[model samples]
Target: MGFDGPTFAFHPDRRAQLRAELDAYYARLYGLIRDELSYILDPADVMGDDYPSETFRVLKNNELREFW
Candidate 1:
């Protein structure tokens, strides 16, 4: 739950190597998206795989309620 700048296994009282891998992956992802993502996405309602939609009308008319 913390980002310390060191490449080593963490969590002193733990029982799973998987968590360390996941933590490392998330740290990298967090670093990657720390700035770039905010510019491309709206501050609100950023959900699901709907991308590059020109407008909501197209989304609605296409019957993409499930995706929306």
Candidate 2:
């Protein structure tokens, strides 16, 4: 079976828009952590010593899927 509809079309512009929005969201989140939370807790301690991989793991984990 096949489907035909305007919604089925691939939209690069929409994809770019979403990507930009996601980047902005993360930038704001990190900015808040740096400005406000850094005084109370070291970002390294909160994020652990290995931050990039740990952050990726937390984001990709199943438990966060629902929240996302």
Candidate 3:
């Protein structure tokens, strides 16, 4: 995942900004989706009191395939 040399031959200057924006966007989107599902009948808080706590940390801001 680490690219050496120029990050982007076309738009290297915007790499930092883009990465930060993507991270935040995904974070908010993840929070919203979790709220929508309400934990698929289990009633869980993905964010938990301490986020990045193994379980939620593993799936941080990303959807994982559950059934099929």
Candidate 4:
């Protein structure tokens, strides 16, 4: 069985909100990663060279498709 009710619809305003939220979420995640890893690695170097794509992959693999 699966969900069978009034499904949520995505609207433009909601899309904008989600985008902002996602940006902030990633920014915070980056900040935390940087702060914790500074002693072992260069945050800017890791983020610039690898983080974006890796983050995208993790999100996709985890099926993080909804934001509220």
Candidate 5:
């Protein structure tokens, strides 16, 4: 299986914004509440200071810009 549709180019910023929007839409469809989505984007919010390295930091930042 592969993409067969026409392709168009988008600036890096625009592509990130679009990806964030799509992720948020799917999160809603999957029944993720705001808090759940937030956690998925940034586990550090709920994790303790000694917790391991950050998770999805880039996605979290991108979503903050595009979703919030």
Candidate 6:
């Protein structure tokens, strides 16, 4: 479902771009802005030490490198 459409193959760069685009789309679909997306990606943006659990850590880091 979340692929490069026609190719439908696994290429690191293409997948990352698609994933980031999907992330942004869903965020907007839910009426969340950039800052809210940031917070959702890494809860630490809103809850620092109080919420030290790593949620979507890898995804967030990858998105930072590829899109954000």
| TM per prediction | 0.24, 0.34, 0.30, 0.40, 0.54, 0.57
In candidate 5, stretches whose alpha carbon ends up further than 4 angstroms from where it belongs are 1-10, 53-68
Q: Sorted on lDDT, highest at the top, how do the candidates line up?
A: 6, 5, 4, 2, 3, 1
Residue pairs in clash, model 5: none
Report the lDDT tens digits of candidate 3 across residue range 1-68: 97678564655447557966775677577774645444431234644645433434344444234211
Off by over 4 Å in 3: 1-13, 32-68
lDDT of 1 by residue, 21-56 (tens): 665577587785733443333322344346544334
Q: Which lDDT tens digits does candidate 4 get at residues 1-68?
A: 99999989869677778966776677687775545444223344555654443424545444455532
- Candidates 1 and 2 compared: the better one by TM-score is 2
Q: What lDDT is reached at residue 40 by model 4? A: 29
Clashes of 2: 0
In the range 1-68, model 6's lDDT, one tens digit per residue, is 66555865568888868878999889989999887787877788777857876679897677678766
Per-model root-mean-square deviation over C-alphas: 14.8, 9.0, 11.6, 8.3, 5.7, 6.0
Q: Which 10-residue span in candidate 5 carries the lowest summed lDDT?
A: 42-51
At residue 23, give the lDDT of candidate 3.
Answer: 56
Q: Per-residue error at 58 for model 1, in Å?
A: 45
Cα lDDT of model 2 by residue, 41-66, tens digit: 33445666665434345543653465
Q: Which of candidates 2 and 3 is the stronger one according to lDDT?
A: 2
TM-score of 3: 0.30
Local accuracy by lDDT, each model: 0.49, 0.55, 0.50, 0.56, 0.75, 0.79
**After superposing candidate 2, which stretches have Cα over 4 Å from the reference?**
1-7, 32-68
Candidate 1: residue pairs that collide: none
Clashing pairs in 3: none
Candidate maximizing lDDT: 6
